[model samples]
Target: MQMSNRIKEIIEVILNSKGYVTIGEIAKQINVSDRTVYREIPEVTEIMREYGVQLNTVSKKGMAAVGSLEDMKSLRISLGMEKQIYIVDPRERIDFILLYLLQQDDYIKTEALAIDHHTSVPTVRNDLKKVKEQLGVYDLHLIQKKGEGILLTGSEIEKNALMINILLNHADEATLYQWLRREGDVSNPFTKRMEEYGYLDVMSACYLRMKNIIRDQCELPAMIKDREYLEYILLIAMMIGCHQKGQPYEKVFETENFKGEEQRVTRQVKRELEEEFHILLSQEEEQYIKWVLHMGMIQDTSSVYTVKNRILDSKIHTFIEYVEDRMGLQLIRDKELKESLYVHIERALTRIRSGMCISNPLIEDVKKDYEELFGIIREGADRIFQDDFFPDDEIGYLVLYFAVSLDKVMKRSFRILVVCSGGMGSSKMLAHRVEQEIPEICVSKEVSLVGFGQENLDEYDLILSTIPLYIDKRNYLKVSPLLSSNELEQIHEAIKRHKYKTMRKITVREQERRQLESRDNIESLETLRLLMDTGLRVIRQFRIVETREKDLKNNLLRILSEESLCSLPETEEKMKKQQSYYIPVTDMVYYEAVLARMPEPKLFAAHYHDDQYLSNGEKYTDVIYAVYPDQASEYEKNILNRMLESVIEDRDIQEMIHRADEKGVRQWFGYQFKQYLAELLAV
Candidate 1:
């Protein structure tokens, strides 16, 4: 035996003797690293399973040797044979190279083959020879040079020809489909060829089914299905047997009828199965299918009668009564197989056979309880929005609201803030429920009714009211008469009917209206922008003229000390003109005067006034003073940029500035000015 075989044997003995050997122990016994020992376990387990030997783990902390000594010996022998690589015929070397390339790294590195193949440089060279030989088979070339090393070179269109050949010759149809499903990009030439050959659709369906089955049957161990065969049979069965046309069995059921029967039989079997085994079937319909297959395959008439009697037995009846008492399902009354009734019955039987049962009934009892709880909340939110008194139960209703909320987030382009009064927990509940309804309309910020008066409501696109909030704001879009689940459904329908494009158009119209108003509002924005630009200019001047030490001190002193011009105290006389004034910039008086003019003037100052250069006014004499002027250095430019930033903290304005910068405005201006100078000289 090889050295690797001997090491593997010693590790296995330690694992069997210890019941659970640590990585360190395995390494010490086998003379390998802990990683090697850990990696070997999975490989060894696979080899052992083929020989009827089992390895079981206890809580993933301990291992157990499950089979007898004889079983171990059989597994050891099988494992030795399994580890050996099958030799490729010389003619089939190209097929091997194609397989190898399929498993290659992201970049086709020509660094000698990866160590795992356990081959020398010369052996790898010979392997490349085989690979090159195979490329010729596909009318392609294996390009190699001293520095460039090896590369598979060919027209992208013909590249897949060799891969297809290998798939056809070396791999089974099912394996080929599985491989293509994972590695073959649909847009790739190879995948397109497969699709053109009509194999891709079947492969996709098989892959989808496999994924669905894994997700649905959580506890069931994965079983590798022959995807191609499964897809072919399923398609035929769906087309023929489901249609009940030209089939061996004349009474073949259509999809609808089959579905109905499945529901009915499933409910019946579930009831009986639950009574006998007490296992609650997690996936009732899937379990029903298995039961149906078992029923279809029955050979004995006596067995059929025995099973049928079991379905109608008193034990089953008693269990049904238990389900009713616990879950409020009066099952005895509903003799007709309704969808839910059939589903419940099937699930019940499935649970019994599986030996895992839950007392929770499959009827509407659960839904009813949740519905009643949320209904009360919906009523409270509606009443609160209407300015009615909130009841004591409003707090409990709030929790249910969030539980039923939508599980999506706002899109990047839009944002909305939800505001509500503190009482009855209506604000939280409304926020929860609305988020549930329209996920894209996020509650970016939540403000209580008390603090809501303090919020800058202009930031949000939509203002949803749980109550009729009267603040003299007209721009807000309101969905009134706060909604229940039914009402919300109506709102959703209205929104969908309106369409996203229409909503966007409305948003655009609103924006345009704001833009018109901005003309009057531009002075305040201009003054703000000037302030930011001034601050940035001051910093830039200090950086360029003063040493690092002086620059730091100057910045510190500027922030720490207040100038008389920066601070303006409000008198009671001036306070009368404005009910309240929260000063944002040093030139509050100037800013307020700008705001007083309203929409039109403000728009001109903000949009039309090109004040980016800080050249609009004299140093310290203008709304903002520039720190440096002579050289107009980068530092001075940075200061001007900062003042403009402070002018408006709005994200949209900043984004506009960024776009302007990207357009190379300075370069454009220089080119135009130079051209004008040349024209002047010519004149």
Candidate 2:
């Protein structure tokens, strides 16, 4: 006899407590009334009698389990509470019902489900409604027949797909890894649930062989390095197991037309699986496996520039452009954003085309924080794809990419100095953790305690030390080298306080500057003098032209030579050594920015009218070439940062710079410099 969830909780409380637990305590713990607890006592007593255990109730102390430890263990296992916590949450119950129905070959009575979950038939019926809605997404149906019961009916492939989705949603990577290795916790609720559904048997049959096959492949080692690859491997094992059971995937697609390294790898994998499992695979199965491997490769590889899918590529470009227009922000210039979105969407589209659903666990949080952006991207994606396949989960992933891009544009990075008493290894580790946890912070320097005493602390925005300091506590925060969660919270609070103080100081300075400005024209002339001296030098070196050349190095050489900013051979040598200096801004307006060191500060910018693809496969119509001296002043750096900020933040400035001629570009720069100086003085 299956015990109800309430009875299980009561028994657990008694077994775990050192002394007897009162009826009122049990009632409160399980959120039930004392009268209800009294009503269930007889049933609990009867259930314990079968396991050789007795439920003993004292006069005023309430009840306790009086039996051998062995009997108590047996009773816990019988109640499914030996290793797992018995949960009565509605969602978990609904998931249990779905899994139960899918694993059964014939109809099961509604009363049976009610009995298994220890709930009312009416509660089970409500859960079935949600189960039916979820199944409909996979084109599966929950059929109810009079007098017989209910069953899940769908293609085997669809059933398998839904099963994988549920498994991934319930269990995390570490748990799945443990399960595949046969070291899984028997007490884990998800593990026990999988055992009940008979999936563990399927996993056991093919896991070892699949692991060996994937491990042997040279290309797969990199892919499997990520824990997420375990999910794919588990899915493959399940598919092979299903085929061995004579329920092969029946959907037919053309397998003969596929080509490339991924296809070759798929063929080898198919041969090995067929031989090991003693089952002949269908053409559709071969194609499905090929698609799965292809997605794995996409996830592993960084650059998808060489692997071209013209139709999907076009759709991605259109999607980016649509988002750009709606948000009035320039996202196309963000190289990492474009590349990452391309890879993600490519895999997403493949999943949709293959009738596989994608799950985003953070979908709710993404919607909450980025509600407006999520809606805009959803509409844009739906309109671009012209289909209903793009679910909110997929759109949520897309929103994260744009949200990160916006943060990069808008965030003010803080410079951090890390001081640790430990060796360089521990100091570096702490620094890495800091950057990982707080994206808005940059670890500018790492120093030992001795080195810290000799350096100027005012250069850094915040100082994090591993050891306690002799100076004022407010000057630095003490954190563990490992940076525990509590220490991380302390650092966050410190940063917030620092930001508030900085803003207050700025406000005070602005008030003082305003009072001085009203007194005389002396300060006003000083601002103009500073702008004319440094800002004019940068604007004077700006150049714009129409070019058809695709080679960025050659274009930079010609422009720098014309302006006589630096030696041609020196610039060429530097360009060859560090190609990272060529920063691609955007494909929407087509611009690249290059930075290098020179004897004097200089900025050489070119606006090309003709569109051309560079050697890196990115199209460009504008290039801003800048060179700064090794000892350039902070004011010079600020001017350059302001220029780039204007191009990114001001749409009108971007258009003016794009359409303006050489002299026109210089005049626009001079006007922008005046505005920059005014804002600087005001701040």
Q: List the residue pairs that clash in candidate 2.
A: 83-187, 333-585, 333-586, 590-621
Clashes of each: 43, 4
Stretches off by above 4 angstroms in model 1 are 1-158, 161-416, 440-448, 456-462, 470-475, 481-683
When superposed on Cα atoms, how far off is each prediction in RMSD?
29.9, 22.2
lDDT tens per residue, model 2, 320-408: 89877666457787888888888788778767776777666577689987766776788798799986468777888999998888666
Query: Model 2, stretches more than 4 Å misplaced?
Result: 1-85, 145-149, 224-228, 254-259, 299-303, 325-330, 410-439, 443-683
TM-score of each: 0.20, 0.52
Query: What is the overall TM-score of model 1 with all chains considered together?
Result: 0.20
**lDDT leader:** 2
lDDT of each structure?
Answer: 0.39, 0.69
Candidate 1's residue-wise lDDT over 1-683, tens digit each? 22357446743554334245555666776677878777777766665565566667666465554565456556545446334233335334434444556333333545544333444566667787867644543445666667655666653223433344444444445444544455311112233334444545444543444444334544321222343233322232222221222222122122232334435544554444334333343353334333333322212223322554454344434533433332222444433222222333333333334322221111133245444334433443343334332222322323232322211211333455666667646667777777777765556776666877887866664566665576532333344334577646644543442344333333333333333345555763553355345443233322111112212223222422232123223211122121212112111101122112111111001111222222332111112112222334332343343333332322332233333332332333234334423422232
